[model samples]
Target: MRLTSLFFFFISIVVFPQKTIKTSFVKKTKLKAESIVSVTKSSNYTSLKYIDNQTLFLKLNDSIIYNYSNVQLGDITSFDAFSPLKIKLFYRDFNTVVVLDNRLAETDKVDFNVVKPYKNVSHVSTGFGNKLWVFNQDSQQLELYNYKTNQVSAKSLPIQSNLIDLKSSYSSCWLLTESYLYKYDSYGSLIYKIKNENYTTIALDYHDNILLKSANNLFYLTDYNQTIAPIEIPKLLIKQFLVTRGSLYIYDNEFLHEYQLIKD
Candidate 1:
């Protein structure tokens, strides 16, 4: 009788395997724009920047056009639109960052080589109160730099993993290493460290939602760390993707696809 009961229990477990319920919903919208190099969405408008050889073209909200070309800065290493009024353009090769106004005009410039201690910065992102979150490669740590004061206001403990990427918002900074992802608050306090699971890239929306890309698949992580796959993505293989606000942008075959994500 005991053997029969154990056999039935084993069968029930196989028949009633747990199911993973998706917690997020998304609606995809396709927009046709040609020869687009990059797209960034802000609270008010979307900025599309394109490059053709030595010349650069920028279209704001599908209407305005801005052109710029500079051989000295080389290719743009990072384009941060965290603040529409104060966009950040980092040239890693030159160890410089250019601040752009809402009109995409150069307003300020910072060269890390001139800073004391002569720190070598590899990554930079917008931060609150006229500051920037920069990754000092020489120290293998994150630093909150006050551009106005030209000082390092805060710094995190030295990270001990191979750095993959770094991203930041007004109030928080996230560093992704080979083994883990670290989140730091505005004061440089370590908030959380999550073990990575083969995530190649990550993006944080304005709402603090985390979106991750692994291989060709994109996944969204809920506050509880539930992995949810967006069901409405295009069938084409995603070459690259980014999340901003409530939208997911996918690039495939020279086409930029935009999807609006709705939380359920």
Candidate 2:
């Protein structure tokens, strides 16, 4: 009985070990901006998506703002900065996607309605090498689409929950559903499924770090462990937030605040 108790204790420690290191946020800079719909950053510039009098604007580096007025494309559902040169704008209402160059020029457009197999795509993000990761609502699965060839290279099994949000990098993708958060590789294989834990928003960085937001608070799960740590931010009603390239940006009161996170 004593030996059995010791074995179980060891198993418990191994399964539920706690990490001591903590992550903290330090405010670095703030910039005044218009009502931002979404924001993304690259090494060279920051992209801000905003609206003005029924017209949408893509502001880069606070110096140039490009205007896009296409009523036929419907509302912008997703703004993805996959590459420094190519940005993806997804329109869910019309089942269309527009690729923009760094200057926000329309370089290409794809309407999924004309594609064979007829993917009712609800979410889209840039994928590895000339591919796009798209979530098909009708099929309840994620597919890797080759835009150049207009073919689905690979697909995942049907997911059970309703997908609420999705973010992706070059090599992997993260899906936030009504019940869980799922991580998948480029081949559409499920690597992990984490419980939702009341998180309303989610973002995944290139390093595979997971950032989750619940109401006004932010939490993150580092790449090294499963432990979730809270990220402190100044007292401001956060309208939206995102994590990119080891930095966190929060939008509140018509201003975007950038913070640098240090893990200690």
Candidate 3:
């Protein structure tokens, strides 16, 4: 009987986690755009890809706002505003990374196509210590690139799967491929690898918790653990989702709904 009970306990934890997500019914605001390409939130700003993918609009502290558009660079693949002072805008089609200031002014640009020892960069994210996390699709590696010195300081072994999404903090980075989710330290060392079940998006919450989305469904995966719990919420058309400071911001076609995620 003791062994049977222990087995059942283990099964309960692995198969029937009781964690849930409550919306908390927060405020909802309409975006100031007809179409939104993407959405991301930072400590003090909310960014939206507006007016055809070329324009980026950012609202700061709920009052100050700024806008930037680059017609020559074409559409922006993504942007990183973790540090409002040093923003990164990636134009994958042009193989360029545009650095912007807090006021959305262009400060610098890195064209991988013309850089010596050319790199076919597919993704770029802010890294610690004046660096950028670059994913080379051709080489299939994550490189810690020193943008100032124009050198790769560290890199991981070639990844076998194609990268779907990537999110990084000050000292760590997470890479999501079609088959696995990989975590690595700042030195480009693989910390762990776990199988993925078709998660299309990954974001860090206010507490730096991992949030994932797959096919209109949201889930949470704990750090360095295999447990994944569903984040339950009221059904809505999810065009994009952003998690910031314990708040879940869901964007539909016109409205941006804000909800506090209450963990039960």
Best by TM-score: 3
1-264 per-residue lDDT for model 2 (tens digits): 999999999898778754433444545445454445456766798677765544557777765467765677866777677574677878888999888776668888989999887889999998876789999999999999998899887899999988888888888888889898888898899888889988888766547887888878888887655567787667777777776677777778566677777666
Name every residue pair that clashes in candidate 1.
none
The better candidate by lDDT, 2 or 3, is 3
Error of 3 at 24 (Å): 1.0
Greater-lDDT candidate between 1 and 3: 3
Report the C-alpha lDDT of model 1 over 1-264, residue by residue, as the tens digit.
Answer: 999999999898677743332323343344443234456765798777654554446778867488665688887776677676787878899999888776668888999999887879998988986899999999998999998888888899999988888878888888889999888998899988888888877777665667777777767765444334443454676766666666677767455667777566
Give the Cα-based TM-score of candidate 3 against the true structure: 0.87
Off by over 4 Å in 1: 1-47, 50-56, 61-64, 224-232
After superposition, candidate 2 runs with Cα above 4 Å error = 1-61
For residues 1-264, could you state the per-residue lDDT of candidate 3 as single tens digits?
Answer: 999999998898878765766668678887655444345566666655444447766654465377888889987888777666788889999999998887789988999999888999998998876789999988999999988899887899999887899888888888999999988898899888878888988887643468889888888776745467788878898777777667787878788888888876
- Ranking the candidates on TM-score from highest down gives 3, 2, 1
Cα RMSD of predicted structure 1: 6.0
**Which 10-residue window of candidate 2 scores lowest in summed lDDT?**
19-28
RMSD for each of the candidates: 6.0, 3.7, 3.2
